[model samples]
Target: MLPYKNEGEIRRLEGLADQNKLTNEQRTELTKLRNERKAHEIQVAALFDKDTAKLHSELEKIDLKASKPMTVSTTEPI
Candidate 1:
């Protein structure tokens, strides 16, 4: 997922750069949006890490289950 809140902050900053009038509440809103985006990014990365670990664990179990025992053959002397 993209960081929409961050994008909004960028837009707001651009407006500020253009000298657009902004209320105090709008400034606070922009700060809140940026913080929320950061938090969301952290959450998404953590979830990805968890999922990757789970997949690796599952693959290891599959490898363990799919392994075969070694066999030896004996021949009589002719």
Candidate 2:
């Protein structure tokens, strides 16, 4: 998923499966890889949700400040 370098073994196994020629070992490996992919997907999604929530919180704080009235001070430069 992160896209480093893989040897395309999954594709090889799938191709073999299409022909109904996959070995037992290959089937096990494919299942393991599929499960790992699911776990990675879940972890990435959780992180994204957390970051989104923090961003929304910060935006809300800024919005609240903006909604308040501003007062001018004589000591402040125009």
Candidate 3:
């Protein structure tokens, strides 16, 4: 029996070929789907980077606050 991994890969390739069948309509549809998916991935990456930058900036502010010495009240002894 073929290994499961090999079987899965073969099946996946077959599905790809089937999806990209020789008909012009199938080809066009495949191209459209692929392009849309690529565009979506780019948009997601940009958003992720923007969010990462914002989080890093916030963390830096927090770290700065943490590094400063705090004043203790005269009534309170450490």
Candidate 4:
């Protein structure tokens, strides 16, 4: 939920992660922060978009991997 709101803590945690030293709870929190940050960025980018689906497709293609895929969706009525 933090989503880099605590910049110092995020950096410290990331340093630990790079050293493979995160506790289970720290790892979970870091994962959540990264996800929330990514979602926030995507939403901001979508605000000026003319084609939401095209944006989603482009992002998916940019970050998607054979072993891991990311999904972005909206339920607003068109």
Candidate 5:
């Protein structure tokens, strides 16, 4: 299942589990759902880290370009 779908289902199950007593099976299911959600969260965080590194590299290139001095050419008869 997609991460968002797993997140929604996890929330729903948590609400239900909080409201009433869970049977052994339901408790086991809840534990599995929680682990799945945590795994997805870790995957998402890794993706974010990759994106952030790419952005930082691009920003550094821009800064280097901005910091360089410009040259001016003069063509005139003297």
Candidate 6:
């Protein structure tokens, strides 16, 4: 899916493509938009992957803390 910021551009391109005729400039701009969208997708995917790894690391730490035994101390009054 196109990013929110590019939704308008995607709509415009869809309208242009639906017309079945494009000016040279329109075609060039369409190609540029497609490349930009592809680059955005790759960047977003990388960010998501990084975030997932970070979350997994955090979860592992939580699990380790939960598995460790806790200690309690009791003392008698002198």
lDDT of each: 0.74, 0.77, 0.64, 0.73, 0.78, 0.79
Tens digits of per-residue lDDT for model 4, 1-78 = 223465667788899999999999999988887777777767766664747778888888766553364445333455
Query: Across residues 1-78, which tens digit of lDDT does each residue of candidate 6 receive?
Result: 337467588779779888977788888888888788888999888989999999999999989977777644223344
lDDT of 6 at 54: 100
Ranked candidates (lDDT, high to low): 6, 5, 2, 1, 4, 3
| Cα-lDDT of candidate 2 | 0.77
Residues 1-78, model 2: lDDT tens digits: 353133376677788899999889889998877677677778888888998999999999989977877757533688
**What lDDT does candidate 6 reach at residue 65?**
78
TM-score of each: 0.60, 0.66, 0.62, 0.50, 0.69, 0.77
Cα lDDT of model 5 by residue, 3-74, tens digit:
555677667778878988677887788899888778888888888899899999999998997777754422
- Candidate closer to the true structure by lDDT (higher is better), 1 or 5: 5
Best by TM-score: 6
Candidate 3, 75: how far from true, in Å?
16
State residue 49's C-alpha deviation in candidate 4, in Å: 3.0
* Candidate 1 lDDT tens digits, 7-77: 85668676884796766877777777778778888898898899999999999987876575533422334
Task: Encode model 3's per-residue lDDT on 1-78: one tens digit a residue.
Answer: 112323444455447678764456645655666666566667778888999999999999989977787756523787
Which candidate achieves the best lDDT against the true structure?
6
Worst 10 residues of 5 by lDDT: 69-78
